[model samples]
Target chain A: MSGQTVANLMRGHIEALAARGERTDGRGANEFRDVSIETGLIGTAEGSARVTLGETTVMCGVKLLAGTPYPDSPGRGSMTTTAELACLASEQFEPGPPREPAIELARVVDRGIRESQMIDFEGLCIEHGEKVWVVFIDMHILDYGGNLFDCCTLAAASALAHAKIPNVQHGIADKDVDLPISCWPISCTFAKLGETIVLDPNHDEEMVMSARLTVAHDENGNLRAMQKGYNGAFTVDEIKTAVKTARTADKVLRKALKEATK
Target chain B: MAGGNSDIKFIKKGKRLDGRKPDELRKVRIEVGVLNRADGSCYLEWGNNKVYAGVFGPIECHPRHKQQQDRAIVQARYTMAPFSVNDRKRPGYDRRSSEISYIISQALERVVMVEQFPRAAIRVDMQVVEAHAGTRCAALTAASVALADAGIPMRDIIPSCAAGKVSDTVVLDLNKEEDNYGQADLPLAIVPSTGEVVLLQLDGHLTPDEFEQAFDMAYKGCMDIYEIQRAALADRYGGSA
Candidate 1:
């Protein structure tokens, strides 16, 4: 979409929601929609997760590959994200080349995991600057209910946590070792709709939302990363509320992660 | 069924395995609306083999020439997901997928009421998420349920099942091992109400009587699957499947 139309449409919704003091979907300031996650559902993939953020459906799969680590981070592993805006989802998403919108979505999701230090990149190093562990995280959008950044994060993180690296068999001059992953970071999103900040915005809500925020947290309620959407300015008060609400949700999210491990 | 193999065996105790008295089927389960995006979608687990199907159009026929004035054309493609099998299957077309797609499309075309849509096309995408045995039959059966779930009109529901020969004895619903090493396999797709076969594929050696026996076994297996198909359709949109 062109910059002018996107800005105009979003700016108008921002003003309307702000003046109303409530969400168009009737959600409270901090209440998240009922979010249910199911893991280990797909028989394929080392680890798989399906997350439905309201109506937006996202599925993530983690595939391991042998590769050389970057020159600087030779001792660490890496993660790559790919998003497909399938023709089945919406007509606006054309088949063929990955459009700018898809690239942006992948980058946004990649930033949350990369910046947060989700994986122990160093541990993935097989031989410094040589052979290393490459974690390929593929994100698929089954439905477009909106808030893909948060939904993809939730799905990717859960799939990572549930992922099991196969027992490695290699020849480093008679030395073989099994790779281990210590932690998986989880990402959750918050949206500022008018005066109200909601968790897990639905598709319609996303269309009408003023600004959306996403934060990645670890099992210990530690902040790993943060991002905001819509290029809107938020007051310090709104930012504080988002952090507080996310931290609270972090506890439940952690529990959800643990239960998902089973 | 083979004697020495993997975690799950198809034969045990000098008889067809999974505790079926030679002519038994694997446990079958079906669920509709498995995929929220597709107009109609369903998932099925016929024992270890799992398949998912979605029906998308009947909307518009593209490429112009494919359109018809009197009836809609059924365009179906059956694909296996990359991670669907034990060894990753590359996305897109393959010999096995193409063959299955042809058979599934032919089977579906027999029952779908194409006249209703006129110049449009009803596209059914069947994905085998996991493959054990009887994948084609399972895919065909699940696709009909998905089509029904999507509320597309059909002359009749197409149900399919495979009956094969193992250790000189015909067994119903061959599992993964039975499919690979069995003597003969006959996969059949039938319309229960009409009692007419729309899909018929046979591989391996079987005498005339043996073929008759296998066909009967497969027919019973189709009926077994039909119950689940009916139940799944009934759960969504409300009606007798």
Candidate 2:
């Protein structure tokens, strides 16, 4: 059978399940999969973490290098988040430079960390405008079971939380120190499947879902970043409910992040 | 001769740095079918080196012009992650990577039965996530296993290893420090069953006798690694081969 035919069949089956207030994997409408994280796996990187949300897996590595800070962010450390939808992760992904989906993934994950003010950017400065620490968060998708937005965000945040300034290695300081972090930001992603809103959509659900909504919240439950994806519309009531659901869901994610980093 | 670091003693008595004999290979670990999306995949960790290889296709070749009417083409890309080395490497393909990629493609082409699939392409992507030394050999070894896992028809698995001269002593598997100051380096890949050398590259200098010894050492190392590759494949299927 053609791929489209299989997708259509699965979509119909998923919609039927949704109509009954259930999910294909037997989870509740707002339930998320089990999340597990491992840290410090990449020895060459200053900090690294591998996060598994259900079957989806991502590896985030942070490299600290001394370079000129950006013109707008002079005296503050700069950061660039790059997401590679590695061909090994999914059949749909191709091998090459970052494409549209990969770019969007990076931007969305960046928005969460940057808007949350998770890192102490100014504290990373070694000199006023001459030199500063630049953090590069490279997110590699090892498996794309689905919901990369939340997985990438979680991986990036956890990696940043574990990062250390290799000051001594660069001969700038007498000792190495942890990267300054001020807050923890967690993101929740929901897929609109027919009339139902499912949390942490898997690969099958993603193929059939009409739209995706991702909301990031800081530890204090303040909204930091939000992105709506796909060519689909949602009612005001649905958006409002999504925000409320995101805030509540973040608590569980934050707990897992804390335990993983600890 | 490449300049050697006089302060560092690469070899003493019959043992080399890291306490290994001249002909000893590093500890190796291999796992196959590690990726869910790729047709085949392999992960390898040799000493401090880490590599991942993924294979795609026997599918249609892209760009129309690159396709062959009578056979498939094996395209290999060997890349090192930015943080794989002591100093951060910029992301993107450089001359070194392109050369290694070309050599790896040629090596695998000798073993894979590309003629079976006309007008198709088999892509092998080898990524070095961490590096100490001998990354090319590690990448090629991993790629071979990935090809086997992909179920691509092949005459044999290609196994690779490197031997180099450090401080006037020929040694198997040069590490980072040794490579930087070694007098000579030879990386070799072979079809173990056929005993045919599929890939060979050398730099620095060595006498004919020393070259022969280094080649012999690298061949032995490749043979040992080939056994590990077979064991990894056997382990994937849960039985002895």
Candidate 3:
């Protein structure tokens, strides 16, 4: 993939983008690319949604099953998060072990959801400490460009919100019923590159960025969790700015999630 | 498999559980030019089933050994996000998905003019975000829009669909219940221009009479889906008329 690097002008091209305080794709700092979301398109899954952030496309599906909750959380239901890097995304991602990068991506996505209390695990309990429903969120990055964190988070949350648990029974009247879930958690990710803070960086900015920050918030617009990627220390002022930005972004994102699922 | 014992009422009053009529199809929406890095990409929603497809390459084949001298290779992968299934499928490849991937690749091979790009490969990547009953059909259909969105040349964008029988009733498109209880299930890939079945699969029991009915129903489905496919492609490709 690197052989076509243009050999020399690479640095100069990126320098132009940095100097102008703009992305190679013409996005302004703090501006996100146009986003569209849709839900209930996948009938096979319990719930599913697809989020497109510019060219960074990610799809999320939520599956439900009756199983014993983890021992540590016997009273509450269980949740799991995983990511798949399809060969269709990029040549860089091969079909195996998912690579360490993908694992980190999945964990960051998981932290945002778990911290948000989005699933309402108590509601999933079929029996107290006996049987319960486990929620599974799978994130698949079908295309690679830039800024997957925000896109993936939104997809997962929307999928969860769009999901409907089936009514099951053991031939007992009281045990079987339809359950419609309420509430949701959504995330906003910001990238800091070359002293410019950008929202929804494209594939190019992601390729040569210093650090990226992702923050998840709930329907109430309260911060649920945060994860910083690419290893860089943050200044007090930068952290404050990021928090403020994330808070404001949370409101807008929640609406998007709702619209996507609706 | 949980058999005929479980109680699930799929249809009532000539309407499905979801409130759709028997002949009516789910609402399908599509968007192209998604995933800017890919050669072509599209996202589609058909009722509760969502599919994201990305078409890359006809550029280069890695491992260098996979490259050929005569024509391009068409490779496809169909995967469900772990959350896409009710049981939370373990994240990895599976037999059913692999089978779909292979069939989809072969279906595409016929439409794509691969000989134009020797020693190259075009990849069709499909991800199912939500699984209703007809994900393979939706994903394959979305992949066609994606390939066209990328400006790739094809005989015609492929139209895919499924038809099944429930309680001796042949249906146009099987919802979750019809699929599960269907005496026979047939999923197919069709090229709308030719009305040909490039990929076909069947399970359960179907007499020769039922098979023909399912095939005809599936063919009609392809034509129905083809209208949406053509409109989407034309929107991006510019109006010919």
Candidate 4:
């Protein structure tokens, strides 16, 4: 049989099971797969984290470097976010300029952090109109299941939250100071198959999902960023319900980030 | 990057900067069948934003390998003119345009009856001649009308709009200033018949209650846009007044 035939068959099976409120892994609709976060994994980097959500694994490294500030925002520091999705992570990813999926992943993760107002960009400034610390968050995907947005966000936030600014190395000061973070932003992803919506969808669920929504919220239950993906539609009620669920899920993910940092 | 200027007031005395109510949408006008050579075409003007959409093919799939045996693939390319915004945008595809193109393609594929045309491809091109915010929603809404003008069968026409929090209040169909200075923005597209959302994206800060209010506002805005779309198509097809 052709690849299309196989995909069609799998989609049919998944939809049938979804209609009955069941998943292949026997997880509940609101349940997330086993989540684990390990921080300070890379010794050379200022800070690093590895997060595994079900079968998906992503590693994030945060590096701080002193550089000239942008012309417009001399008093504040800046951040550059980049993601690498290579063939090693999944067959679907190719070796080229970052594709749409990788780009989207990086941007969504960046928005949550930037919009949350968590990072104190002003504190990173060494001198107005001159030098400032530029924070770079790099995410590398090691495994592919589903829900890379949440994994990447989790890893990036954890790595940033625990990162130390190398003040001594940059010659700004003799002692290193912790990266200034005011809050933690947590993102929860949901997939819609048939009429059912499930949180933290696995590889199979992602493959068959008609639509995908990722909602990010801060510790105070403030909605920070959201992105809806794939070829699908949802009712207005469905989105409202997702927002309510995201508020509840924020606590669990925030706890994970805190525990990993500790 | 950082939040916009807080000094600029977007709402005062229950009216917006444009002297409109919070629930009112910006002035909108859409023209269908604008292109002579294309199978279908549409031009849309919403506030200061100007967008054009053209549809072509159900033709033979290119490169051969991408063609599916069972169904046609829908390809949508969203691009912005260099002079569209306040700053000159770099020409050609960028990360932002690529992502927007992808989501628009997905939403179009859902409505277009692609399975009816085997081993073929439908190309939809959207160009933002001017942008003042909400260009993606405008482009997608225009493309749907262009598809209809091309005589393509669809499950339903999709209408798109945005609702956002400006001055800590949820308002419908935010204009450029409101979008930039607002606390949050939610762009949504819905199939009016089924009340199903085809596209949704949100950014900035909002509480759970604020999100609900914005969602409701945007949903109603989409319904209003739907009526306009139907009327535009009816005007072209000589339907009932």
Q: How close is candidate 1 to the true structure, as a TM-score?
A: 0.77
- Which of candidates 1 and 4 reaches a greater TM-score? 1
Give candidate 2 misplaced runs (Cα > 4 Å): A1-9, B1-7
Candidate 3 accuracy as TM-score:
0.78
2 versus 4: better DockQ goes to: 2
How would you encode candidate 4's per-residue C-alpha lDDT over B1-241 as one tens digit per residue?
A: 1365567788889999999899999888999986543578788998778777877767667658989899999878787654355433544569998899899988888889999999987778786756888999999999999899989889998899998888777888877787777778889998888888889998888899989988999999999998888899999988862
In Å, residue A169's CA in model 3 sits off its true spot by 7.2
DockQ of 4: 0.01
Q: lDDT by residue for model 2 over A76-158, one digit each (tens)?
A: 99888888776566656666777899899999999899999999999999999889999998888877787999999999989
lDDT of 2 by residue, B94-195 (tens): 899999999999999999999999999898888787898899999999999999999999999999999999878899999888888888889999998899
Query: Scoring each candidate complex against the real one, what DockQ results?
Result: 0.22, 0.54, 0.42, 0.01
lDDT of 1 at A182: 61
Q: Report how far residue A82 has shifted in candidate 1, in Å.
A: 3.9
Quality class of the docking in candidate 3, CAPRI style: acceptable
The DockQ-derived docking category for candidate 1 is incorrect
Residue pairs with clashing backbones, model 2? none
Winner of 2 and 3 under DockQ: 2
lDDT of each: 0.73, 0.88, 0.75, 0.82
Segments of candidate 3 deviating more than 4 angstroms: A1-11, A16-20, A25-54, A86-97, A116-126, A142-145, A154-200, A213-228, A231-262, B1-35, B45-48, B169-171, B191-197, B220-224
